[model samples]
Structure formats: structure tokens, C-alpha cells
Target: MTLLSWSVIEYSAKYDAAGELGHVRDTIKWGADYLLKTFNSTADTIDALVAQVGSAATAPGSTQPDDQYCWMRPEEIDYPRPVIECQSCPDLAAEMAAALAAASIVFKDNRAYSRELLHGATTVWNFASDRAGNSSYLHRVIDSNLARQAGAFSAGKDHGVFSWDNKLPGAQLLMSRLWLFLSPGYPYEDMLRTFQSQTSIIMCSYLPVFKSFNRTKGGLIQLNHGMPQPLQYVANAAFLASVYSDYLEAADTPGWNCGPDFYSVEVLRSFAMTQIKYILGKNPLKMSYVVGYGQNYPKHVHHRGASIPKKGGDRGCTGGWHWRDSKEPNPNVIAGAMVAGPDRHDGFKDVRKNRNYTEATLAGNAGLVAALVALSGDEHGLDKNTMFSAVPSMFPSPPPPPAPWKP
Candidate 1:
């Protein structure tokens, strides 16, 4: 949701000129409104929220196959789905805050709607901070211990990817960006600074030269952290890398220093573009991970909606197995949909049943959209170089030129 908001917010001018801004806003509003409904906005104190609706299973003990177990259209489900509510979940609350905050930016032209979104952001951010007190207490204790022992402290292990389950990195980046747009004398200035610092750390960790993450032989950033199915995460990582570069450009920062190494913004952007190109058919197999793109792409994407024929009569939960197992290309093309990508060796199997390499997820596509917008030419058709200057030196200036030879 946050990524979608970012896509429209960062590129609204370009999209508006292209006559697509209204459509994007309508789509983002649909999602934001649904998220708003998950909790009671009017309540004096917000706590729990409906975290999930339904599941892979249709009911507690029903023999009917559910969405995950069978290749059925969502419209075919006739059961009342169960819901999962959560309380005291800081991570979830923080992510909601990020989404609402970013959406508020997208609708800033609509004063009333923007205000409502900001209010929701404030509510959830408070909830997250309140629930995270225990962690803050532990950190304080650790700080005191270190003060007494004069011991060095580390920032601990880094997360390999910014993902749905782990929203800290993305949330922090959003919160920090919010600081720039907020009014003066904001009470949360300190917290926003912390967010900025943490966001910088996460981006620095992705530097290939830093050896913090592995890169595929084809130059795709691989932050799988040893997961068997890793390509699902590459899109999200690429999104963050691109978005961070946009942030740096917005702040007029030529580059950032990570310890002894000073990385120019070009370095960061180069890393992001590499990942994007790899997904768009720069890999060993020369296959585009996105459907309906490039000369070669995945034909048998693992999605029931795409696989089943529009005119077919066998659209039932159990009856679609023939289409699912069929060797033919999908009757419907999910254009611009990014599927889970190739293996470590840049190898990909185009078979429909290979869900690990064939599934197209909303989160993955959200990231892809935002990343594409960020890397595209700036607003008013201005190239990025025209808007931002050349890279500056990260170290001391060189000695002055020698005295003139002529007198």
C-alpha cells in the first residue's frame, strides 16, 4: 500500500500530464479506504485491528478446498470467512502508519481527505510507539551497561530485504521523508531523525562493494539470506534502493558517507537499475520476469485468474485443475505483472506449477511500479541530470594548481 502511494506521490506531475493520475488516485483510495475500515477510527483509543480475513482454508473443518489449495476464482467462494485480529503489534501498526502517511501525501490536494489520512497516521504511530516500549527499555538497559563497561556496541544483524513481514526499513524511510514535509516545530523531530539515520544504515548495508549482500553473476542484487525461494524478495529490495536514491536527490545530497567509504548517488542508482534490468530480461536465460514484456517472458504464470479460459465452463474450485496443469500459455495475460524470478544461478523454469518462480504477488508488483517511476525521467520531461548536479568529492580537496609558468 505504501509503495503504491509512493508511485503516485513521487510521479503525480508526470502521471497527471499523461492523463493517468486520476486512475492511480482512485486505485490508491480504494486500498486506503479498505485499510481504514479494518479498525475503528472514531474510537478514543485505538488498539486492535483486523489483521487478516479468511485464509488458505475456507472454514475450520469444511472439506471444501480453499483458494490456496485449489485453483478457484475468488468469486466462487460462498462461505463466511474468518478474521484474525491483532493487538499490541508494533510492526503492523508502524506499517499502517507508513501507508496512511504516504497516502496523505498523495491526496494533499483534497484538504479534508488528506487531513483524515494524517489523523490515522498519527493514531497508528502512537500505538506502535506505545507497544514498542519494552524494546526501548531493553535498549536503555544495554546502553547503561555499555556506559559502565566502556564496551563497543554494534547495530546488530541487518535485515536482507524490505518485505511485507518486515516493514521496519520501509516504514523508517517513509517517516523520515515525512519530516521534510511537516511543519516547523514538529514534536516528533527527534524520532524522525532517528528514522533517517536507521534508513541510511539499511541502504548502506546493500552496497555490493561493502560485501553486505551477495550479487548474482548477472549483477542482480541477491539479499535472500539463504532462503530457498529468494526471487520473491529481489523486487522489494530493488524498490527500496531506487526510492532511497530519489530521497537523496530530493534532499540535494550528492552522496552519503558509510564509515570510511563515501558512496556517490550514482553508485546507489546504478545498483537499483541493475536489479530492474535483470528482472526485465538481462539474466542468463534472457527471460523477462515480468509477463508480456521483452522478446521472451514467462508464459505459464501460476495464477488461476490468468490460467482459466474466460469462455470455459470448468471454472469451479475442483474443475480448474485441467487448466492449472495445462502446458498451453494462459488464455489471459497479466500484463506488467512481475512473477517470482529465477534461481541463484539466474536459471528460471517457465512451468505453471513452479510457484516459486512463477507466482505474481501484489507486494512484488507494488514495489516494481514505484521503482519504475523513481528511475524514469523527472517531471516536466526533465532528465535527472538536468535536475541534479554532478557527483561531488567525498574527501578533502586536492592541492591548489601550481603557480602560473608565465610572468
Candidate 2:
């Protein structure tokens, strides 16, 4: 949700041009309202928040199938789905604060609703701060460990990926941007600067000139070897890299330095563009990772909602499972859905059961939307290099999936 909010905040002009600004805001508000509802707050303090909405199973040791094991639609979820609450969860609280804060900025025109969002952000931020106790937040920990030396900022490294499971890299960049709005010595000023410098390091790491990231033979960044899911990380890396380029342009800094080497903003933006183009069907398989984008995109997306038909009768949990193993293409098309993408060797399987390559995630699509918007309708000074030749006139059979990548 935080990523989704940032997507709008980063590309408001594009959304406005598309006549979808209000729709985007309403979408964000829906997520923000749910976030606010997760908090158990009174006045200025939060007692606890719902950390999780669904459990792994029905009971502690029961073998009964429940939410996690079931594949039924949302309306058919009648199982014992419990909400897990937590008190000292700084990560969750802080992410919620960030989301609400960004959404507040989006709704700033509506003073009343904006104030409500700002109040929620403030309350959640305070909760995160109070629960962290000075030892948990990234900046404070870096300060404690490095004694606020220049090396303290430079020591941090970014894997060039961000998602629901990790918010540290995203938080650092956001806080770094927030630092520009603060007065010197305004309590967390130094902390923000530390984050700012670390953001620089993060951006530096993604630049191809730095040679920090490993790219596949077909030019896709090989970070996680495409295990579990790959496109989400690629999409996130592209989004953040593009955002940092925009940050440089906004700050009028011209470029960034990765140690001895200096990379222009154009280079950074071009790297982001290369990533976007790769997903849109420029890879080894000449396959678009996003569904419903090009003719050669995935037809067997590993999603129940996409694979199953929307008939009158309710297809209970067991019925849904039958659809999961079907060999046919999905009955429904999830347009603009970014799937898990190819392996490190640029190999992809369009099998319905292959979650690693066919599954689409909200996080992946959020990043994709942000990147697409950031680079939309503009192609000034982009790298036009291709990793492989055009698809053969006479198509050949695809090679088997490569062995698991080793460092």
C-alpha cells in the first residue's frame, strides 16, 4: 500500500493527464482507511494494531483447511480467519505511518480529510518511535554503530530491491527526501541526512557503471536468481532507480558519484528504462513479463481469480483447486499484471502450476505502474542497446530451464 501511495505521489502529473487522478486517490484512500482501522488508538496514543488479518490455519494444531489452504474467492471466505495483534511492532507501525503520510500529501487539497490522514500518520509515527526505544530505527542504529562518521553513511549497502517483505531501502529514500523539508538541528535532522547519504549509496549501487549488480545474459538484473518470484524485485529496482534519477533532477545535482566514478542522471534514468523495456518483451524469450501487454505474454497466469470463470454458482474451495491444476489458459485476463518473470538465465515457463514464473503480485504491479508512469511519453537520451538478436524468422524450440544459479 505504501508503494502504491508513492506511485501516485511520484507520478501525479501522469495520473492527472490520464484523467485518473481521482480514481487513484480513491484507491489510495481505501487502503489508507483499512490501515487506520488496523490501529487501536484513542486520543494521541496507539495501544496495539492488527499486525495480520489471516492465520496460517484454522487452529494451532488442527488439520482443518482454512484461509491459507483454501483457494476460494473473497466472498466465500467463511472460515475462522483470525486477526493477529501486536504491540511493539516498529516496522509495521512505521510503514503504516509512511503510507498514511504519503496519502495525506495526495489528499492535501481536501483539508479535512488531509488532516485526518496527517493525524493518523502522526499517531502511527509516534507509536513506532516509542516502541523502537532508540535502538531499532535504521539511522539511530547506524549512528550508534559508526559514531556518526562519514563512513557511517557510506557503510550501508542496498540490494536495489524493495517490497512488502522489506521496507528499509524504501524508507531510507523517503526519509532522505523528507530531510530536504527540515530545518537544521530539528531533532531528527542528522538522522535524515544519514538516510540521505545512504540513499545516494543505494542509487550508486544500481548504476551499471558501478558493476555492483549481476545481469542475466539477456540483460535482466539477476538479484534473487528468480526463485519464489523475480519480477517483483526487478520492478521495484526499476522504480526506485527511476525515482532516484528524478530526485537528482529535482535537486539539480546533475549526477551522482559511486566512489571514483560519476554517473549522469541520464544514465540512471536510462538504466531504469532498460529494465522497463526488458519486462515489456525485449528479453531472451522475446516474452512480455506483463500479462495482456504483448501477443507473446503469459497465458497461464498462476492466479485463481484469473484462471477460474465467474459463473453463477459458487466454486467452493475444492472446486477452485481443480481449476488450479488445469492445462488450459486462464478464462479471464488480468491486464497489466506483471508475472514472476524469467529465471536468472532468462528462461521462463508459462505453465499454470509454475508459481515461480507465472504468479503475479500486487507489489510487482505497483512498481511496474510507478516505473511505467515515470518514464511514460518520453524517450530523451535512453540506452538503445539490445542484449540479443531479434527473434528468428523460423521460431526454434526453447531450451530447458537452466540449473540453479551459483555465485
Candidate 3:
């Protein structure tokens, strides 16, 4: 699920780097189309989305002929696929809202698809917000399902496979950004109110001032989770930074200045860029957590399908367990996947089972896409409708300088 949302946001920017616009559109559209299938614009229920695949009461692939310890292929799995839907969860609704809204921009040239995305985004947001008070009921439904099923079902109280407590603000901001774009700067009453409400929550409650979300000398966002601290808030910070960059553009201050505003654009960009560089190989670990990118990286990604085809020392019964430094390199390469990352001291322990350091999924990379695209000077018409279109028209270039003097 995280992979679905994160894929759209990051793949678009990845295409920007590679100049493969068609591939980027194709990659993002795949996830966006599936997400649309999960949602119903007229209804305010989870029926629009499939809460679980495979065994509803048990884990995926649990029905295979092989035992629990054996590898079971997806085609061989047979189980009752029960779909669950409810209205109490706001987090998934909000994520879908953000995902579809962002994709709306990606498909802006396609009027019907873009409008459909907006409708879906608005529907999910209203659905979630209407039942915000009843969100606590989620635990009951999930726990009851877990009781009924004798398999490894991902039954829990949370609204997602992973919690989205810190991610809500970013989701809201992205949705708000899409709202503004679709409005074409003509803000409607409901849309404007939603934007204001979301922006206030972020600026007044979750920014550098918030104590529960921020507790560090360096201002790293921290949560009470057992995993590393920065993972909780860094991505959202990057998203917020992109949103802030948009804010700065609208303000149109001379030379992209900062500090005059309550939350400076420069501060936001600095935090976003630092976190991005850290993931791209700029820490004490000195390893790029992004697979197949730069410097040293974790070879043994904690992904089942990506590693299933390996051979030799890299492919035994326990071959996937080769996370230690002495282990053979993982034969399969999962490119552009951002793994679970480093500790506060910039230390990384790479292993397939190390969810703290080696787990990589689509959810973690969504913000990576935002950071990269914003850092790319809005090359893909994100902030602008067309690339290099109006800049030269608005401000004529000064004459070139004389040939530089050779040393």
C-alpha cells in the first residue's frame, strides 16, 4: 500500500532525472489507476478500497502446500479473500486523498482522469473527516478479524500498515497544493477552508515549535516509536519544504528571500535538503540507503519477490538472511528503493530482517520524490504549467559577458 502511493510521487521525479517523461507518466498512472479503483467518489466508505488481499483472516500466501518455513508462490496460494470497508479510519483516507490529488497534477493534460482524481480525493477527505471522532473503532474491527483468522493477518488498530501520525500534515499539505492547482488560484469556500485548516495544523501545531513531534538540538522530528527518530518526521519535513517552496514562489519576494516570514523558506529547504543528502550517502554510515544509486548500499533488501530468483551463496534456504557484513552480496538489485535508514549517530546495521535499517518500500520513497522534484527546479511543470516557457519571456536575459581571461 505504501509502495502504491510512494511510487507515483517518486517515479515522476525519477523520470525528470532520466528525461523519460513517458515512462514516468506510465509508472505513476499504474498506481493512480489502481487507487481510483479502490475509491468511490459518491460514497464515504472503505468499500472503495480493499483493506486486505489474500486471506482476510490470515496472512498472504498462507494456504500454500508448503509449510510456514517454506517459500510459497503467489500463484499457488488459495484462500478466502474477504474485503473490509469502514468509515472510522481517517489516515488511509487522507493518504489516498493526497495520492490522487498529486496524481491529478501528473495527469492534468488528461481532463477526465484529472477530474476523476480530484473527485476521488475530495470524496475520501470528506468521508474521513466526517468520521474523525469514531476512528478509535478501528481497533475493534481489526482485532475481531484477527481472532477469526488463524493466519498471519495484518490485523491492528492503526489506520495503515504503518502509522501515519507524523505523515498527516504532509498529506494535508499535498492535498492542499493540489486543491490550489485545480482551483487555478480561484479558491472555493470548502476548498479554501480545508486548506486553511490543514495549513494551520502544520504551521501552528507541527512545525519546529511542536514539542511532541520535535525534540532535538538539531531539530530532528522525533516520535515515541521504537525505531529511529528521524524516520518519523524527515520525509514530512521534505514534503513541507516543497510546499514552502511553493509558498515562497507565490509570495514572489525579491530573490527568493527568507526569515521575514514566520517560517522561513530557507530553513525548510535546509532541513529538506539535509535529510535528502543523508539518505543519498552523506552520513557517518557513508552508505546510500537508496539501492543501486551511490557509494555503499544495503544489497540484501528485505523484499521477498525481489530476492526470490537468486542463486548460489546468495540463494539458499537462509540466503535471504545474509545481512551481516561477511555475507555474500545479494544477487538481485532493487533499484531506487529507499531502505529503512540510519540511527541518530548516523550508524547503519544492514540486514534483511533489520526493519530499522534494511526495509525498503513505496511508502518511504514518496517524500523522496517530492524532495528530488522540488530540488530539481520544478522541471516537470509542478510549480509551472510548462518548462522554461515564461521565465525568459518575463525577464529578458542580460547580454553575455566577454570571453573569460585564461589563467
Task: Give the TM-scores of the predictions, in the order they appear.
Answer: 0.77, 0.81, 0.61
For model 3, give the 10-residue run with minimal summed lDDT. 152-161
> What is the C-alpha lDDT profile of model 2 across 1-407, one tens digit per residue?
67777777667767777787788788788988998888853347877888998776646665465755667666666667778899889878888887887787777678888788878877887888774232344445335354344233433333445667766677677665555432234455766677777777877777666667778888887555445577787788787878777766766568877777778888878888898899999988999988888899999998877887877117676667777778888888988899988887888889988888898887788888877777775522221111011112223468999999999
Candidate topping TM-score = 2
Candidate 2 local lDDT, residue 173: 73
Q: How does residue 15 of candidate 2 score in lDDT?
A: 76
lDDT of each: 0.70, 0.72, 0.53
lDDT of 3 by residue, 243-352 (tens): 55555445442122222445555555665677677778776667887899985988877665554453323333333233222345555788888887766545677776
Model 1, 7: alpha-carbon shift in Å? Answer: 3.4
> Which one is best on lDDT?
2
Number of the candidate with higher TM-score, 1 or 2 = 2
Off by over 4 Å in 2: 57-63, 131-160, 175-194, 379-407
Question: Which stretches of model 3 miss by more than 4 angstroms?
Answer: 1-20, 39-49, 55-94, 115-167, 171-226, 229-232, 254-264, 310-326, 378-407
Candidate 2 residue-wise lDDT at 204: 77
